[model samples]
Target: MLHALINGLGLGLLLAIAVGPIIFSIIKISLGYGKKAGYAFITGVCLCDALLILLGNVAAEVMRSALEYKNLIGIIGGCLFIIMGIYSFFFGKKPDFEKSRDIQVDYRKRDMAKFTLQGFFINLFNPGPLLFWLTTCTTYSFLNTNERILLFSTTLAVVFLTDFLKVNLAQKIKRWLTPPNLAKLHKATALILTLCGVIIASSVILKNFISW
Candidate 1:
């Protein structure tokens, strides 16, 4: 149980910190449409992740076979994130508050549902989470069913918590979205993406050669 908790915590943190469209989308929605919209979007993302985890478990055998190529996949995914990070850092634009005004008046339940579906599809189409779940499921296949549940539950909890924090933080920073500050935010995101890429690629390389 303890081992599962630790493993789940680590994986969850990795997912939360991974530089992906979902993270940016969360921030964007929060800034543009407020917390309710952000919450709806993240709820969709979480549901998609949970579903993927379930599918990964069901197809554990196939995913295990896929793990033979994890090193390649990891490197590729990592590079993609790094490239995205670089692009965002160099070309990211400042927030346009012109569209973000009167958010409360325009937002409705239907809009919430729309955002939820948008979030779901955004996550669903992203290959990163699928591969991530596949790799994680295959790696943890030794755990019994109950242990696996606990592990993944813990992971989900951490993921949701981190996303919640992101929403809150984004909301709080809305007043300070000056051009210079926005540039700093973009740069920071780029750095994180680049760092995550290095870590992912290096981990795979080490696993391949280090006999760990």
Candidate 2:
């Protein structure tokens, strides 16, 4: 159990660290709404991730033979990572607010249903999470079943917590940066994203060639 839990969480975190669109979405919403709203969105994302995990488990059970195709999983995941990095580098968005003070809208506070739902869909529809799950979830499911589930759940929990923390912290930190510095930060993030793409692509290529 412990082994599964540890393995699951470890893999989840590895994928969570990259500055993906979802992370930027958290920052954008937080800037417009507030820390609470950002956290709410993150909660939605977690639920989405949990759903994906369940789906992966079901798929694993149904398609046991499919799991052995590591190269296929890696190719798909690598392509996703590469695409996301390209998008981030070329066209990523940060939250845009003209004023530092929170918006004075009381309705958004009350009508959080839309916000939460949008957040959830944003994650579910986004390609990154799917590709991330394709590789990571399969890897997790390869372990002992009970252990894998426990590990996946625990790892996902930690990822949700950490991502929530990072997004909120980014919101707070962005407050201090001047426009130029913020622009610089965006550029840096784009570079990091591009780097992630390169790494994933290289891994896929390496795996492909080695098979020959």
Candidate 3:
């Protein structure tokens, strides 16, 4: 159990550092709506992680088979990525973050439910996230049933902590960076995400048919 918890913590930390749409969404929520929305976004991601964990546990075989169709999942994930990238790339109509301090929102409080649901869908549609959990979380052996549950709990704990910390830290660092630098960062994040989608697609496609 200790080993599983430690391994999960490491995986959670590394994944938290990934700069992608999810991270960008966290930043946008923070800058546009403040800490409440930012936290909402993080909560949504944690929920998504929990859902994947549950799904992997109950439907491991189905998920395993589905994720193994690398090219198919890749194509879908890639299309979503390319589309999101284009949208963000041409998202000139949206308010720039630097000028968003005065934007007024009318909700009594930010609807965390909405944020969470949207975040959940984004994760679900992406495919790779589920694939990752199915492969990484359940692929190995544990010493006992208690150990497995402990590992899942530890993974969730690490996920919540690391994700919240990253969102807050990125927003904190935003103040020091110039507009151009930030724009570049957003673009870079988009590219990396798109690349991940592509890699998943290529790997699966190759594995599905081409490897000798």
List candidate 2 stretches off by more than 4 Å: 65-107, 172-212
Off by over 4 Å in 3: 60-110, 141-143, 175-212
Residue clash pairs of candidate 3: 70-204
Q: What is the lDDT of residue 24 in candidate 2?
A: 59
* C-alpha lDDT values of all predictions: 0.73, 0.65, 0.61
Per residue, candidate 3 scores C-alpha lDDT tens digits across 12-32 of 664654444566566666766
- For model 1, what is the alpha-carbon lDDT of residue 111? 64
With candidate 1 superimposed using the best TM-score fit, by how many Å does residue 165's alpha carbon deviate from the native? 1.1
Residue-wise C-alpha lDDT for candidate 2, range 1-212, written one tens digit per residue: 77666555655655565444566566667777777787777888888888887887777664456666655654555566566556765776653434434323443687776667767888899876776566555544445577766877787878887877866687565565556765665666556545655665576578679987
So what's the TM-score on candidate 1?
0.63
My TM-score estimates for the predictions, one after another, are 0.63, 0.62, 0.58
Pitting candidate 1 against candidate 2, the one with the higher lDDT is 1
Residue 146 CA displacement from its true place in model 1, Å: 0.8
lDDT of 1 by residue, 18-73 (tens): 55567668878887788898999899999999999999888665544676566666
lDDT of 3 at 78: 51
**Clash list (residue pairs), candidate 2:** 5-151, 9-155
